[model samples]
Target: MTTDAPVSAEQQRREEELVERVLRSFDGCADPRLATVMRSLTRHLHAFLREVRLTEQEWEAAIAFLTAAGHITDDRRQEFILLSDVLGASMQTIAINNEAVGSATEATVFGPFFVEDSPEISIGGDIANGATGQPCWVEGTVTDTTGRPVPGARIEVWEADDDGFYDVQYDDGRTAARAHLFSDAEGRYALWGITPTPYPIPADGPVGGLLEAVGRSPLRAAHLHFMVTAPRCRRLVTHIFVRGDDLLDRDSVFGVKESLVKDFVTQPAGTPTPDGRVVDGSWSRARFDIVLATEEEQR
Candidate 1:
């Protein structure tokens, strides 16, 4: 090896030593707060690189891939989140933090496709249009564990088009299949939408490249996304997955939880949805009740 190269053995040693020195900087941290977390993260991350014998070329490629993921973020999209989803990090975090949630309501990864301030729709409204799936009506009651009603509960919902693309992804305005509804006096909430079909997550960018490199497929099971928050209810961001979606076990994000999976029922066509959209025979129905942990419990 030539000594004149940009980096030599001595240079590599010096660089790794510098990393070690930087990692120890947080030692004896009286706060034991952020510093503790930061130092542990540093140790594990450095160990991972060493354990994998990560190469310079691979590191550079990883940096470039992350840069590209950041480049795709916009007002309506977050590529970093998409990357995290494909990496299974997001789902893991959700699972770790929500371990105590009972059979009341299951939480899942909130994808990069959510649109806040969803258009308001009435109970029994039809959220799906131009769908080529089953026919059914979604009905459920939002309540606490004691089965007490939760009135005026706000439920924000969204789902992919029949083609597996969200309205925002297609650059469509806040339209059908994405709306917010509130629980009625009975703490009952219902909506009508098409049966969901397994769809691929974004696979045209750096995230896609990484997935391909890792031999992982970029597919999410058919499901409906919901974020429910009320004054007294512990907020929940979850999905109702299709019972038999082909991708259930292989959800690219690892976002599928057994409790979150729901049975998709089919009803007759031309059934008048509470929203006044006549079901065209191809629709699906799901029922999920949300339970709230006390505010103090969440804390």
Candidate 2:
């Protein structure tokens, strides 16, 4: 490896001048917050370049990588989101915006697979509308931080199948393994899904190449997604991970939290399900009681 020479005093002075000029260009921004963000972003970006002593070839390579990512993105696949997730940017942003408030459930990254207007299922209904996996029984209660039940809260849930592929990843135009349901009068809800299994983020794109180059794995922990909302409560987008999942500590998206890990108790075949449903094989069950902060508390 060739050694990089230390930046000389004159070169450092010139670099600082360039950064100041770039910052000054944003002075006329009418939005005060926007101006501040732009200035700070410019400073950090310039500092990073200076620290790395980035070469022209490396900058060109970065541009090409971004171009490839853009080319591979589509309505079904989001390369940029995968890139952000692998880089820990998505989790970092979530942490910054979702400070812990009382005992409200912690928030995590919103993976790119979420789709709007998912079919709604009734309480105790099955969400696995044909996707393959071991059956899972999910039950939970929605409550405010004060322990009052929050009935009628909408809970949207989704996850990859046992094969580690979301329905959207297929070209069949079918929806499965995802649905939304509302809490009952008692703020309780239950549904049937599949046990989550560890899966790698899409590994055929620029982001995947970057991870490999940096000696990183793209595997996310086994988990199920949830987005809960109510009239007077802060919206929650989070996941409950399998407690014993081997990949929990090394989730590709860095979305795991101690509070979000839960046990998926295994039930042998012939065991009666909560709703009197029958299963031909073993299944799992989990409970995730959620508490939401009020809108005012979120502020």
Worst 10 residues of 1 by lDDT: 1-10
Model 2 scores a TM of 0.98
What does candidate 2's lDDT look like per residue over 1-299, in tens digits?
A: 12377777998899999999999999799999999999999999998888788888989999999999999999889999998898889999999999999999999999999999999999999889999999999998999999999999999999999999999989899899999999999999999999999999999999999999999998999999999999989999999999989999999999999999999999999999999998999999999999999999985
| Each candidate structure's count of clashing pairs | 5, 0
- Per-candidate TM-score against the hidden true structure: 0.86, 0.98
Model 2: CA > 4 A from native = 1-4
State the lDDT of candidate 1 residue by residue for 1-299, as single tens digits: 22233555785797689678977898767887888788878878876775566778889998998888778877877889888887779988887776664445878898887776777878877666554345457788888767788889998888887778788766546465788899998889988666677889888888888889889998888888888887866788899887877889998989888988888765566655545666555555567777865455563
lDDT of 2 at 222: 98
What C-alpha lDDT do the candidate models reach, one value each?
0.77, 0.94
